[model samples]
Target: MKATEMRSDCPISSSLDIFGDKWSLLIVRDLMLHKSRTYGDFTKSAEKIATNILANRLQLLEDNGIIIKLPYPGNKVKGLYRLSPKGVDLIPALIEIALWGGRNISNTYDGSPFLKEVKKSKTKFLKKVMDDLLEEETNIG
Candidate 1:
């Protein structure tokens, strides 16, 4: 469904309704940045999302058309989830959030490389991510 058709009353509320959950965004981040595709990969995240929560978020993301599951070529019972175009669109927002956190939040691990890339050329960073996503999707397919 189109974004226009998704909600009419309050855009923010509608968006939040779709992506308000913390796990959902983290799943998206993993898919976007780490190219994580399986349940095992998500469970291995630094945040250590619970198994049941991860399952629910994956289902929700699939239901929302933000991700699609493709079967593992050699094994029909196994499959992998990858971002759809709608999901890939969240990259800019993620970049902004990462940059903001890197700037204001104090953390031991320096995110300077990512921050510098984002600051120097947002367009380039976005393009690179888009390319990477496309490449990943192609490989999966």
Candidate 2:
């Protein structure tokens, strides 16, 4: 939304104001898994987010400086989306959420491998993931 529209000065609330939607974090998750993704790629996600909602989330994320939209190579009608550094910073939080879900949710999808990596050494896992993302952004630039 906007700075003036935030529900409170609470950090959590403020952050949510920017990305408190069902699909925004999913979009962020996809970018975490790849250097860049196209609109078409997002549409193909298992979540099957609607085109209108996807379009809106993309715009909202870009507006909030959480993602960067770039011209897709040799494509006039598509754009590549990747997380901005701010978005990358959310990885730790996402990991925590994943950990919680894995432990508390019933019938959660198999994510043992990743969870094991984090449980084995959260520091190392975060460092590698964040470093990889930083490298990807640098290379893109």
Best by TM-score: 2
Compared with the true structure, all predictions reach lDDT values of: 0.80, 0.85
Instruction: List pairs with backbone clashes in candidate 2.
Output: none
Model 2: ten consecutive residues of lowest lDDT: 1-10
Error of 1 at 37 (Å): 1.4
Q: Supply candidate 1's per-residue lDDT for 38.
A: 74
For candidate 2, the TM-score is 0.89
Measured by C-alpha RMSD in angstroms, how accurate is candidate 1? 3.4
Q: Give me the overall lDDT of model 2.
A: 0.85
User: Per-residue lDDT tens digits of candidate 1, residues 1-141?
Assistant: 233245556867777788887889888888887654777888988999999888888888888888888886787776788889999998888888787777788872455566677788999988987898899888875
The superposed Cα distance between candidate 1 and the true structure at residue 52, in angstroms, equals 0.4
Overlapping backbone residue pairs in candidate 1 total 0
Best by lDDT: 2
In candidate 1, stretches whose alpha carbon ends up further than 4 angstroms from where it belongs are 1-8
* Candidate 2 per-residue C-alpha lDDT over 1-141 given as tens digits, one digit per residue, 9 for 90 to 100: 544369989999998888887899999988877668999999999999999999989988998888999887788998889888888888898889878888899987755667788778878888988888789777765
